[model samples]
Target: MKKFLSLILALTMLLSLVAVSANAEDITLDVIIAQYGPNTQEWFLGKGMDGSNFVEKFEAANPGIKLNLEVVSWNDLYTVVSTRISNNNAPDILNIDVFADYANEGLLMPVQDYCPEELYQDFFPSFIDQSVIDGTVWAVPDLASARALFYNVDLLQEAGVEKVPETWAELEDASQAILDAFGGEVYPWGIDMTTDEGQAAFAYYTWGNNGGFVDENGEWVLNSDANVEAIEYAIGLVNKGFTNPNPATQTRYDLQDMFAAGKLAMIIAPNQLPTYVTDKEGNVNLATAGLPHNEGATSSSVGVMDRIMAFKDDAAPDQAARNEAIGKFLTFFYDPENYVGWVSMEGFLPAVNSAVGALVEADPSFQAWLDVLGGAKFYPTTKAEWNDVKQGVIDVEQQALTGGNVKELLDALQAKIAGK
Candidate 1:
């Protein structure tokens, strides 16, 4: 009887160990984050020797959780994410731009269900509104960005321009003066007429000029008088020798590099450029100003936000468990302390309003960004129509700026986007 009892006890212990192992296995989760462009390697892998320490810290805090990260180039982010979704093999979490494309699709999970309402209210209304669609919050604003004018003070001084421009006419005058002063040795401005950056810049200028990309009924309105005038003004800058020769071939990076090297007097770029400029010890005299508006027009520029998305279908049998883990991670990431690290390191404005408090207390240089966010506006919302409209606008603007007829280009663009 004693031998039989001993055998029974051993078997019971073995069963309990097996059950524990199963529970541990069930707790592990797979998460994928997309990092693209020049910033990808930094964002995912971290900057210097502390490679993936953030990921390590996260995993250490959450027992039995495993994270799988893949670093993808920015060029392939959209394609890979889209293909995964179409193949019914999406990641547990994904990062998406704060445009209408991903939000319009029902691919992302509503974060509001997992996050607290108070937390949700902490973001700027415009920031929150962009992520909310069809009465559901599909994503959380991870980062927010605003456009500004970056000028080389030395160049401006060389041109004998006492102050940077605040209006369209002032910009033109400044440009012309710079042209006369430098005499082809330097370009007065370096504006990108490329597809992505140029379209965004053009939209802001046109909107500031009282034109917009879409009407109340969602029709394309790029051919409006205000837009035409804005495009003409942009082209006029080039004609007056205010812009670099052949801006159509210039990319955003190229323009920024030129401005940083003091080759260009002025450039329209994101507020984050200051961080990059400061890092390179390029020029301490660099100053950022709000984007100039059309004569007698209000100050307005295109604002963009980045968001974190999670798919419900991808969560599978462990949906609730995975959602809980993701919610915790997001909360931790957005926590005022941890969030500041990411934002400051990444050189992006914080999406959380509470983070503004941290920024003020920690880094005063970012105060200007907080002010910029107060009046920022996002791209118009449309389901699956963003890419089409964006491409159409770029095509038209490229043609118009490259000696093509502005009226005909705008007309064709409007018609093509409107399906006319």
Candidate 2:
């Protein structure tokens, strides 16, 4: 009887161990984050997960929840995702800059289904509104940024300009004077008219002139009179020899490089630029301000936000378990103490309004950039066909820089985007 009882106990122990192993195996949540290169992963995710990191903390807080991360560079992410879709395999979570395509295709799950109501409400409405379409909030924004006017302070002073340009007239005057002073040595402006940058520049100028891609009622106003005036003004600067010789060929990155080397006097770029300029020792005396507007127009910057979207998988045996893990991770990720590291790492404005308020108090230099976001605007991100529309806008803007008619191009673009 003793021998039989001992054998029974051993079998019971073995059964318990197998059950534990099965539970552990199902706890892991797989995630994929987009990157431009391997270095971008390093910068965003840090060296490795440990006691001091987001992954470790999240795992510790939610016992049995292990995060498995995959980093895909931007150049290859789409191809990889498409192949995985063909196989009916998708990561539980994915990072995307533009979520509309995935949302429209039914590839993403509405974050609201898993995230808490209060937490969802905590995000800035402007940022959150962009992620919603047809009543579904498709993605949760993780980081954000806004545009600013960056200038070489030393160069501005050298050109006999007293203060940073505050209006179209001021900017033109500053550009002409700076060109006359640094003729044949430096370009007065580092204009980026390539497809990658032309649309953003156009947005700022259009908004600065009190015009926009869409009006308050969300109507297409790309070819409004104000936008026309803004475009003409920008082209006039180039025609009058106040900007780079060829604006159409240079990308924003190329212009940033020139600006850092002190070869270009001014440009409207993202707020992250000051650090890059300082790191290169390119211009220690650089200054940032709101991009200049027309005399009677309100100044506005373009706000940019990126998201982390959780995808629903019907094939998973325990979909609820996956959703719970996602909710827990997002809760931990956006907590002020934890989110600050990611925001600071990427040089972006905080998407959380509370965090933004906290940072504005903590860092004085950040205030100017944050202040400009009060009236910031975003592109027509909710449109399912925005990708094609955006490409059209880029093409026309680049064509305009290379001598295409501004009015004709914008009118055609407006019609095309409106499906006319």
Cα lDDT of model 2 by residue, 1-420, tens digit = 999999999999999999887876456777877773334466435653232555666777888788887778776787887787778888888877888877888988888778877778888887888889998889988877788888888999999999789999999899888988988687777676676657787787888999977889877887899988898888888888887777778888788888999888988888889877766677547878788999999887888778889887887767777788888878887888777656765677887766776677777767777776656888888877677666776776677777889999988888887875
Model 2 TM-score is 0.87
Error of 2 at 344 (Å): 1.1
In candidate 2 the C-alpha lDDT for residue 176 amounts to 84
Per-model TM-score, in order, reads: 0.87, 0.87
Pick out the ten consecutive residues of candidate 1 with the lowest summed lDDT.
44-53
List candidate 1 segments past 4 Å from native.
Answer: 1-30, 34-52, 216-219, 381-383
Task: Please give the lDDT score at residue 122 for candidate 2.
Answer: 82
* Prediction-by-prediction clash tally: 2, 0
Best by lDDT: 2
Candidate 1: tens digits of C-alpha lDDT, residues 1-420: 999999999999999999987867545444555552355456545752155545566677776666665666566778888798788887777776743565566666678656766777776777777766666767778888888788888888978999889898888889889989988877887777786466776776787787877766756687988888888888877777778887677888887777777778888777788777765567747887778888888877567788877776753666677777777767766777667766776778888888887777777877877788767767765335667767777776788776888878888877776774
